[model samples]
Target: MSAFHVKVKWGKEMYPDIELDTGEPPMVFKAQLFALTGVQPHRQKIMLRGATIKDETWDGIKMKDGVTILMMGSKEEDVPVEPTEKTSFIEDMTEAERNTMLQLPVGIKNLGNTCYLNAVIQCLKTVPELHSAIKEYKPKQPESSSLLTLAVDSASLLTLAIQDCYKTMNSGKTAVPLILVNLFRTTFPKFAEQGEQGKFLQQDASECWTELMRLLMQEITAKDPEKTAQNFRTSLIDQFFSGEFSCEWKCVESEEEEVTKSTDNFQQLLCHISQDVKYLHTGLVARIQEQITKKSAILDRDAVYTKKSKISRLPAYLTVEMVRFFYKEKEAVNAKILKDVKFPIVLDIFELCTEELQKRLLPNREKYKDMEEREIEEERALKRGKPGDVIKKPKTRSMPFSFEDDLGSNNSGFYQLQAVLTHQGRSSSSGHYVSWIRLKGKEWLKCDDDEVTSVTEEEILKLSGGGDWHCAYILLYGPRILEVVEEGEETEVETKIGEET
Candidate 1:
């Protein structure tokens, strides 16, 4: 059968309307009960119709609507009790203790002017699929010695180094990406440039991000070969992080020339900042349609052309780079723009897509709106309930925005900001970069080299450029998930059905 609601009994408490999906293992259901009853999943002993439920399957037991499940377990406290009753401050705790209490991820240490690399790595780690692919990556030995084969080996070694770095960070210690940095510098010699003081020069984080993604795209393939063949995207980077743009170029000098159409793949979108551009959306719109000089067949010589482009495909993860730096001829440096450009927490790019894509996005957009409204109504009902009343949470199901055949494409043009990399100086070469990552709800983690701290949504919004303060340079946005729920008016069900013996 499909998913259905059931009642769970634990000691003197009764949780009604606990939805269980038969497709998933019983352990998942038990985990859900664990959330409500505070009992560990392994310790939860569930019984239905006098038959003990196994962790793997629900074989002989038949389930229906409103069935009763008896669960027996006790919540274990993991933290040790303090001897003294005095208040405890975070400053008094050790590094491990502080990280545990704040739920912050480990930071990366800088090896002299390596903040750009650290910031880019931290931002990219937000994509769990990338990490999974790296773990499973195994490069083949080169059969014959060639430049191409050596390049492949280098890329593979870099991927392995990144995997090791991630493993070290997961151990709750500061990760020093020395091997990864060496591999990166060897692959891209420009990053190895040194100043007069024999110190490595600082690099642009956006450029570093682009180069790293390019390497990953070359080395990391999809986990399932059959699925990859059917989808035509061989690499996980292409499947999850690449987008397609459709463009039309028309000659402005010769009206009789036919408009040329083309499509191109891009891993990131550039937002050009100008005096008229006060918001990110405006900058992106202005960047997409511009005038260029090209050779026209009708006019033999170089002629002005109007290039208009629109997004034909969107990926699960979208990267946007702010064009805040420009090369100065006199200073021989990339000067930074300190103009403030406002961005949104939730961005909707429906207007920036092709007509066909916009039509495909409507269904999921409407479903998302309906689910949000239902959640609001449920919250209002909970507030109206009597004091000390326990309300059953509404059941939610994962809804994919893309087509069934497309594994990692986004059908809905809605995105939520996941990570932001900001620069804190006037020049790209001299500025320091930091990564701000969203941990959950309103909580965020700020990683500045080896220092990691917790911040809020309010602080993240202030990162928009204005002056010498930290200005958002690169933004990583993930698809906004839509959890579809059943259509029914929630009523106040009694919390206690019957007292347990």
Candidate 2:
């Protein structure tokens, strides 16, 4: 019976009133020491008096209440410190070593039910322009003058927190966005809602994405002010994520009423899921034209109207949200639809645009086709050429996909899928969220909380909602850039306004 309470001293810290049982192996005490300090049990060296403690048993050791024991060890370092010696280069390493050195991007740790926030942050980080904006954001002192001023200050602080988290992740360490999570809870009180057990409840990922964009819209502005002078959009969110719809409203019941026309701005496109919708394009098309009951001026009463909307302006980065959750009266919850919907890697919205916008998009569409054909021909010629033979490079041509006057407006209605935020559960309120981001050509990264793995293009296509597996909730699409190569210069990729090179 050698059970007694003792104090352990490690480095400058001391653990007081630690109960130890000698009946159990000495390894248990080392494990307790490892828990107190970050050092592993194997690395821990415990000393009682002048004798070293054995891991097998406490044979010759005699301990009393309040006895002080010395422990020494250091926790393993996650990020390597700068070496005092010569730096290693990738060219000096073998092929296998080089492959090992190339690591995937780090992920964010989930704080309670913050997977929705983590997933949205990862997907948004893939946008080069957004990342640059966050890096450049300067925080100001808190202003308590008015509600609007307070909101702006909060948004600025949130942006800085996100920048700090990104820096930590870039250092090859998994980031815990503790400050950002707190700021988000403060800014949007809805996220602070707790469960009956006093724990934070899971939320919808799409809702989190929308709220974050709203906060960013308040703080992030365009990098170059000169380019945004002619356009109505001055904020980065407006320039990169906003789109305009040309809408026409016609009274369905009153045939004599005149059709009214209007324009509406949208941050993201909603893809409404229904029994008739099997493809993403079809769902979006169905959403564009719908019947609504509203007050009519000619009828002077509530009447059914047919509203038709067409894309008048397209942004550089297109956000499409899948409307999978619907409110059920019986359950009083946002239930999810598990129907499978197909989405394409390359999306063409030529048919979904206004007639005038469609006309303007034809020239750039033709240029993209020509570039693809030329690239195929060059590959064939390279395969046929002999060693040391030089194939003449094609002359470079200007391919501007963005409109000149409207800084971030896309001239061509074409987009490539960039990132996807997915949810896995039966309902929106209780589910796991994960982010899948495209890395270079045909390669993808699946970020599940603090675990990140490499995935292929074929694997990404299977995320289109089917069952209990991951379902695509939100999809982010970036403009498909056309690359042109010059004889004397390297190939250049075109980008939208405010985009980093």
Q: Which ranges of candidate 1 are over 4 A from the true structure?
A: 1-91, 95-97, 100-103, 141-152, 223-232, 375-392, 486-501
Q: Global lDDT of each model?
A: 0.80, 0.80
TM-scores of the candidates are 0.75, 0.74
Mind giving the per-residue lDDT tens digits that candidate 2 earns over 1-501? Answer: 567888888889876667777865675565445434547555678898978998767889998888999987788645678779787799996533343467568788898999999999999999888988887666543353332211124566567668767866776668877667876886788988998999999988888888989888878877565664244466888888888899999999998998999999888989998899899999999888899999988878999999999988888889998999999999999999999998999988888899999998897787788778876876676677655555654557656657776667778898999999999999999979999999887789898888787899999999997889999999999888876555576654443322221
lDDT of 1 at 258: 94
Candidate 1: worst 10 consecutive residues by lDDT? 492-501
lDDT score, candidate 2, position 219: 82
What lDDT tens digits, residue by residue, belong to model 1 across residues 1-501? Answer: 767777778889776656777765575565455434546455678999889999768899798988988998888645687688677699998775588566579899898899999999899889878877776666654564332212234576677767767766776778877667766886788998999989999998988998999889888886554543253387889888888899999998988999999988888889999899999999888977899998877789999999999998888889999999999999999999999999899888888899988998887788788777876876675667766565555566678755565777887899989999999998999979999999886679999987888899999999999988999999999988887764574643344212110
- How far out, in Å, is residue 204 in model 2? 0.7
